[model samples]
Target chain A: MQIIFQIIFSLFAIAALGLVWRRRADGLLSKHSALWWSIIWLAVLALAWYPNSTQVLADILGIGRGVDLVTYCALAFLFFTIFRLTIKIESLQRDITKVVRRDALEKNNI
Target chain B: MIMILVPAHNEAKTIENVVKQLLFVGDKVVVIDDGSTDDTALLAGNAGATVLRHTLNRGQGAALETGHTYARQSNADFVVHFDADGQFDFRDIPRALASMKEKNVDIILGSRFLGKEQKIPWLKRAVILPFARNIDRLFGSVSLSDAHNGFRVMNQRALNFIQLTQDRMAHATEIPQLIRRYNLRYAELPISVSYHEFGQGPIGGFRIVRDLLVGKFM
Candidate 1:
């Protein structure tokens, strides 16, 4: 189980690093965002490698199990991503409204 | 001159009729066809309305803002925000416009509750009305009997001052707050609303509340 978990962790870390690099090269991700994502992936790799450390952190946090602590962290990350995406979508909607409004006015010469 | 601005989305069936009615009542009519998949734009244009087409479906509030921007640029004396659902009575316009002039107010908002002719569903009256009224009382500055009536007439000054950011139904609440924010004089006119073909279900009522809360926080 430990060996399989390590292999999975290593694969995910490599994939995340590769993704960050590709996104940065494509100019889709800024250098700052790439760096931050890479750091998060590295931390994920470290946590996966030493699951016992999660238990120590869990003990400090008064959580019942290391798995519960990891679950909470994963849920928090998911929520943060969702929140960021929602904000981005709303900003895009506003921009689209401006563009569409301009186009509508121009089309009708109003 | 009173210029009627109608915001329509997938209201192809009633677009032409609404435009015609408004044109008969007002000087000019402009319909904002908010990315309708149907023939709303073509019908409205054919009905003697200047059709402004939004490339995307933003929302009713966004469409109204677009129409208002155009109306402002055109220097219209008064701009009437009318729904494309054909619920509002054209006869009420004279009274609304008259009240606006007589009272020296910049805006005349139409209220269904002010009249006995309005046929409000029991569910909406019991659940949606009280909740919407409470929300408006909490956040809105100008207190009115009705908070979500879409029929309103605003002069150029009021239009220039009330900037609506909410692209959805939340604009109904946002407009009154903006009225208070800008210290624009406003009055409520008794208007009738027919719910015969009003398709908004119970879920839509809840969605409005959810959108208002989300808009408040975000």
Candidate 2:
């Protein structure tokens, strides 16, 4: 069961890495974003191959289990990402408003 | 030139009458149809109003900002921010404008709590308004009798200086904040508002607060 889970996770990471590379090649993603995603997927592959590797780091962090440490880190990262996205979306909304307002004014000639 | 700016969204039922009535009070009536699916823009135009249409449904604040820009470009001497739902009395327009000059103020806000008795809902009068007033005071740095009155008359100074970026109901609070920040002379006049089934309720009040907080941080 453990080996099967490891194989599935590793395959998923490899597929994600492939998609990221394709996106980078198609000029859909910046080099910085491609590198970041590549690093993340590589870390996922490493953890899937050696699940116990996290235990050493978890012990240093005073966490009882490697999975629990990973869960906490994942949640924190998700929250931070959400916060950054929210700020970006708000700025984008403001920019869209400026364009819409200018268009409305011009169309009416008012 | 006085320009009555009405920011409307899906208020087709009341917009025509609102625009016609407002025309009597101002030199020109401008109705901003905020991406309404109905015939708001058409009716407002037919009723002798300059109609501005937002292609997307931006909030009332965005609509009003567009109206303000129009008013500025057309060289309006005074701008009245009136609601399209017909809750506000058109007769108060003269009084609000007069109060601006008499009090030597840049802006005059309509307050339902003052002077004449209004048919404000008890929940809004007792609870929502008091809480909103405190929130406005905290952020706006000014104590106003009515924190979120839609009926306001602003002179050229305010028309040029007060730019609303909230793009929603939070613009109500943002107006007061600008008044304080810019040291603009503002006065509150006793005006009546008719409560209808369509206006903002308690839930809407919470959304305004949320928008206000998010706008402050983001």
Candidate 3:
């Protein structure tokens, strides 16, 4: 029963990430960012499945069967934050490149 | 009103002087300090410009985005990009902006080749300029002698029109690409670059190439 629950939870997590990526996805970020993030998500899933890792995490947090739930939530938040920051930085870099090119056009093509 | 956005990192030695010069022309100057461990943000802010900080040193491109977002949100009628490295003369800004207005162009770029006395490094003329123009002529129709310059003014239309999907040095290469892509009116004026007494290498060769390639994947 526990194994089935873990599998279902893993599938749901992936589905949610897919939804976010599909809805707001921009050209190649959808590909690059997803690839990195999925690796992180896979690690989290591994931690969730490891019985000793789960018990130790639960003990550290002083929780019960709640370790699984807490781990999943924490992993999701961590992955999401890093993913968002990467995209933000990508857009920021794009802005500078645009400005320099615009300057070039003004002097020559104008 | 015009807003000046200077995106800098670890430029403490030069940013203050640059801010002081920019102050002469624009209504406001904003600096995006991209994870500068040095006193770049403090110096720029102390020089009477508003400063925005990034917690990590993402890159120069990241810094520019911060400045642009701030300028657009402030509703600037026109915005110009400034370098924190203190290379260009901002007094020329009035000329660029006026030309932008007169031509009804979305943006006006500066070219060092226009001025007979423009002081620039010989290597740039020999190497980077030729390479840049060739790239422009072959893979793109930008038709400009230079594409990596940082001195420019974007009218609110072009300011809003710019879609900088590129997040790296490719943005420098892509400016003309995007301009043509967006069908925005553009003008380039004669401008010069001052190589520091201690010259830096061709500004961003590897990173620009890498980023441009990475952008293709993105």
TM-score top scorer? 2
Interface RMSD of each: 1.8, 1.3, 11.8
Worst 10 residues of 3 chain B by lDDT: B197-206
Q: Tens-digit lDDT track for model 2 on A30-99? A: 9999999999999999999999999999999999999999899899989989878877887788888899
Q: In candidate 3, what are the lDDT values of residues B1-218, reduced to their tens digit?
A: 78998878799999999998888998988887777899998899899988777766656555666566666667889888877887878888998988887888888888877666666667867787777667555435467756577788898787776755555455666777777868888889876567665332466665565556556545
Better of 1 and 3 by lDDT: 1
Better of 2 and 3 by lDDT: 2
- Which lDDT values do the candidates have, in the order given? 0.86, 0.90, 0.72
Worst 10-residue lDDT window, candidate 2 chain A: A82-91
Q: Total clashes, candidate 3?
A: 19
Clashing pairs in 1: none
Off-target runs (Cα >4 Å) in candidate 3 are A1-110, B137-141, B197-203
Number of colliding residue pairs in each model: 0, 0, 19
| Ranking of predictions according to DockQ | 2, 1, 3
Model 1: lDDT equals 0.86
What's the TM-score, to 2 decimals, of chain B in model 3? 0.91
Best by lDDT: 2
Better of 1 and 2 by DockQ: 2
lDDT of 2 at B62: 93
